[model samples]
Target: MRRWFMHLGALVLAGGAAAQSPLAEFDPADFGKVVIQPRQSTSGAGGIAFEQAFGNYQNEPVIAYGEGSQAVRLGRPVGRLDMLFEDGSTGFCTAFIVDDTHLLTNYHCIPGLPRDGVQPQVKAAQFVAGYIRPGHGEGVDRYTVAPNAVEADRALDYAVLEVFGDPSQTYGRLELAGVDPEDGEFLWIIGHPQGQSQHISREGCAASSPAVSGEGKLMHTCDTLGGNSGSPVLRLSDKRVVALHHAGDSRTGYNMAIPMARILAVSKFLKGAEGLPAAAPAPLPEVPAGACDALWAEAKGQGCAGYGAYLASCGTHAFAGLARNLQASDCGTAAPAVIHGALTVKPSGGDFPTLAEAVQRAPYGARVSVWPGVYSGPVYVTKDIEITGAGPRDQIVIDGVMHWSRGRGAVRGLTLRQGVAVDGGSLTLEDNVITSPATGIALRGGDAVVRANLVQQTGEAGVSISSNGAVRVEANRITRSAHAGIEIRDGAAPEVFDNEISDGAQSGVYLHSGGGGVLRGNEIHHNAFHAISAKGAVKPVVRGNRLHSNGYDAVRLREGAGGTWEDNDLSGNRAGGFRVEPDAGNVLLRGNRE
Candidate 1:
């Protein structure tokens, strides 16, 4: 996600210089990678276990219908990543050649951003191509990663790194598809799962429908594990790279990948195939009131006498009716009175009977206000609009899922039952009460402002930010979560501050799996676990927070996790204050007392 902690001025840590030193000798057994457990799914539609399909490569079982000859050669460019962190730890991921010099992988695979005075955790890394089987390293081409030659976007969860040598000349790089994969289209993944030999997951793997896929991400039923983080998802029909496989969720019974198109749109080091569709033009900036007269004169010069004529001539213009609306108005006191489209949803005698109907019928930039009543949902928002509950939050409730994908909007003053899921775009979730069997507010691949809300008793986290979600959680009270009060993982780095979080079954604030962010000025206590817990390459900035009376240590850092912890009050914790595991990396502790 977005880098929230910028100036980490003069970090002070114990054994910091030693942790930053290069390893004198490399030992495979000493450094270890995080092993992500495979989430089990009872649904037959879920991914087939890796053991069942490609476990015995000698006699690969036919896992899907219409068994045919497989294109095993497509795995040529795929490779396993071996990384050595500065902390003397190691990890492995998957990567593939995208061009002659550059390779594509997950940002989390090399989750290091050397900024200001901080250094990247990865001291050195290499890519091993053509490692087809365990103990079969002969003939495999190894290339070192070019120093500081990495371009990554945490929000997109993709990285492009230059290799020291042109290994693609031998293996050949893969071309990215210009478009997203069609729903239900079969896809293939070639990678090193669990750091094993190169294996292709093709049988029964297909893209999920758009309704289920969300935005900016392609959900698929592909068998993958921790080491498969950066695998390229290839379209079975054209054999073109369509997405970059990233994380898997057992709760959803699908694995998630970053769409190649989304990555190409913002990438500076990579380009899409020829004939890639052009992006939509950005909306024009708002016109100033002082320019109204000049604009009106220009319109009149074009043979447009009135506002109606000007609108007819330039209906697509951003200021189509601005001049006419402000002709006789003072710029300061009598500004243009602009009217926006508005719709109402009520139990009866309103523009629409259901919130879903109003949202579907409302045009972009419209307002949909809900009256006092419980509304049944599964409301899918796909346009830019504001949805506000006109009555009290509890009086106007949404009793099911509210899914917002590829839309920018605000949802305010409502009591939500099954919770809200934001997949992409920017959304403001404010002044609402949310309760759910799962996460009260789940964000993936989007920017959201979650402020001044009450989220309680979620079966999962009260607020779960994952898969590169950029969120600002402020002034919220979260309690009684079955999991963490706020769970951040899979490269999400949210800015969380000024919140009251308590009574979580897990940590009040839990971060792991390349997650980092700034947690400041929060009141966190009475959790079953630590008040704040971080692990697995995370580096959150925890400062100015009152943390007390937790079941375990107030703060715990393990598994190469390190960050700046400053001026936090750590008192009355059952297991003492700060506990850093032996394998923990460089943690900066300044002005903190137990």
Candidate 2:
């Protein structure tokens, strides 16, 4: 016989009252919204419109779980996980304790499993339990997740990790249900929605009959958002975990989750009836001395005729080890014809026909040389590799976006037509000519070195850095940008020095939205707007630059902007040298000659 929680309706009414109550220091902007793409309707008949489906949505604060109720007790194991990536960006997700030393979360939240010598992108991760609201909670405690002790499956969209401090001993863990939830069974979800205080979706949450989708995901109607990716879906009847919420489609009025039973079927952590022991870590493979010499001899013996086949026979791990050995050995010199250990890409009749093929086949930390030809666009680089063009920049072109997402690498002596975007890694982009329909270079969450490049005629700013992005912009020629020559926003602080910035439709350099950086020894002139414009909580250090011959003022600081300006040559402008608005926060002007 199944037992259900009584007074469910009363609990929901109490939840509404709690949600309406205001809390201190609750800033909506601090929470990052998870953007979910609209999925095609599974039902041939178009589902109810999004407006109608969510018109009476019933998601309540976790406090609504009620005092001394089973809902509150079961929610004790849920927590908010904060992740710091290798690129210096931070993100948050939801997770729950499964065992004394283990926690469970979505695979997408922690994609880097520690097997096969692959390092995870997440540099650090911590879980905070009882985070009921901003600055408010009940017995809140924080624990760190061990980076090396992670078991994950991308296909299943789940990860089981060992928490270093064994947090479950204090909060207890949720028990997985032996059977799947029945059709139309009432369920409830508890998680941090949009990185806010924990919330519960229970009023109208229910499991659909025949809930399993083609991908083995359970379809349900639960109010969820971006940070709710790893929330536990519990059966109201028994308070046992039944599913792991992963995604939602507002258009179809349905959310998807991985059934707990399905995850248990393949979980190595938990074993049959009597739980089995966790597997021990595997030993590292040994690379014998002269391994690189032997591999190079084999490739040369084949006359490089079957280089692709040879790479496959060597295997990714083996070749990666060999590449390391070669880098450390004396045979690492660049040969005039066919450099040893470096893959060559040409338009035709080379080691690889395309740059993409060469990059994909190259082992970790390998070098790829492109020989004076027009390669295609949208080349995605995920590892550390140096790609250099053989001839002049204009002769070697990549017609689309060069997206760098992980590791550290460099691209030199090439002409990039569309532009470059770095979101999750460090890239050194140097000695290149770049032009684009949009911003010539966009940096969101990574570090980049933009040096010795010619950037011109972009649809937007010549270079843009935003949202925790760190870049060193130096020794570049920037001109004819549709907007500012360099635009910085959203908490980004970069170093700008020794560049020629001119002929922009807007300011030569614009800083706003809490952007700040050091601008030194640059020539800024001939812009449609001010030479430099700072606004809205920005505090940049402007020093030793020749800000003259512009259409507007040399510097304009307004709307609470504050910065240090010293030793700048401000003359020959259409407007005055400096315009500091009364509302500006603070300005330090010294030795600036007009």
The Cα local distance difference test for each model comes to 0.71, 0.71
Error of 2 at 590 (Å): 1.0
Estimate, for each residue in 1-594, the C-alpha lDDT of model 1 and write its tens digit: 222221111111122121121111224443322222222211221232111122322322122121122343456678877777676545557889987789898776676434444665777778887676455556677888853447889788788888868877566577788688887888888887656667677766888886136456788877765467788988854467888987654446677888888888888888876433222223334555556555556765653244444443333355643543443232322112232445667766567878888878775556777766778968988766789875446667788889988556799988899999999767899999999999999988677999999999999999988847568999999999999999888988899999999999989988988888899999999999999998899989899999998999999999999999999999999999999999998999999989
Angstrom error of the Cα, residue 17, model 2: value is 99
Off by over 4 Å in 2: 1-340, 467-470
Candidate 2 lDDT over residue span 396-488, tens digit each: 789978888865678998889999888866789999999999999988877799999999999999999894766899999999999999999
Query: Against the hidden reference, what TM-scores do the models get?
Result: 0.45, 0.45
lDDT for 296 in candidate 1 is 55
Candidate 2 residue 146 Cα shift, in angstroms, is 68
